[model samples]
Target: MSEAVKEAVAEPALVAIMEQLPKTEVPARSPLAHHTEVLSRPTHENPGVRLWENALRTHLALRGDAGSADFARGVEAATGLALPERLQCHQSGEWALSWVAPDEWLLTGPGDQALAMEMSLREELDGHYAVINLSGGQTMLRLSGPKARLVLMKSCPYDVHDRHFPVGKVVTTVLAKSQATIRRVGEEDWELVVRRSFADYVWRWLVDASQEYRLSLGHPE
Candidate 1:
């Protein structure tokens, strides 16, 4: 399906985004930087998972009594993408459909387009349902490299072997001190998505665990 961005923003819109960016960035020497750098940390220590202090995108958590015909129809009409069929995802152009549960899903996109997306979703569904705009409640970490999968195996119980988790895999599972939606972005990269409150705790935990592997590549130049 297809949806359009409303493109409604005042001059100060960019200023707000700038103010929210995390003070620290992975330096040139860090593995995550342009060179042989590593991932950087936010200014503070988070709790459950790694959190980007300034959320660069928007997220919506939706819950509907989807067993009903009306709820399903409304949702399908609202987003070009169909609701995931039994924990599966459907993508139509710019949108993605992620199965959060039997009754819920997370609709996500650029921050500026959130309002338009919400309006479209609200128009389609009724009955005991909820759509909370979570633009500021979480963050993203795009993890990659030859050793990214190994790092995840050490952090969580979910199996990380290629035989078990192939490309296009997404699962919400546990990490040390927190839980996250670990997705395989590519053959070498993975994303360790964490919540806003738990960003610090997860960062520290990752660093400590990675130390044994000589993960000094992430240190600042």
Candidate 2:
């Protein structure tokens, strides 16, 4: 085989799929659209936990060899954020990367930037790696305030104590009756990545659980 042919054969056809938002000015309906009345309510004084849907953000499930130096370098080169270690998350600007498993990570960014980010990743990465756009399948919810940890403890069986959970940690665990990929984003803030179908149920459950300490809705950060 000629050198030119070998180079052509080595390059794989791009297979990454990106979900595009509507080009027109149509109003987007989130999973919690019907609950706007509840979410529109004003925040209570010193509420225990503040709730909001981080809806429509881009979510990408990245599968590759974490042990490979090339893989790590390519991901950072593409996303401007490092692939996190086991059960950890790293955020830079509008992008966040969370480790889901030994060889899997979740990359999230602005909803409109999904396609561009995926293309960048495809350009930088090679070999047995996969980049899947999961933006449509999932939505994120932010839970934060003074009593956020207490609310999480009430919902999940996992030990969410600061000593164990800590900042920058992520976990795939139970949230009330449904499952969620949970991450601690700050000393008092946590994020829940849940399926669109389960978003309403999870939101309702959190509202009920947080009532004792007072619950209020806020815009996603």
Superposition error at 198 for model 1 (Å) = 0.7
| Model 2 spans > 4 angstroms off | 1-16
Report, for all candidates in order, the number of backbone clashes: 16, 0
In model 1, the worst 10-residue window by lDDT is 27-36
**What local lDDT score does residue 39 receive in model 2, on the 0 to 100 scale?**
60
For model 1 the TM-score comes to: 0.66
63-166 per-residue lDDT for model 2 (tens digits) = 99999999999999999888889999999988999999999999988998998898899889988899988888899999999999999999999999989998
lDDT of 1 by residue, 1-221 (tens): 22333444322232112222234683212112232223443322222222122235657788987677788788789887667755355666656667778888877666567777777877777657777776566655655556567678888999989988876567888998699877665687566667867766776676666554444333222
Model 2, position 127: C-alpha lDDT score: 81
TM-score of 2: 0.90
Per-residue lDDT, model 1, residue 156, is 97
* lDDT of the candidates, in the order given: 0.62, 0.89
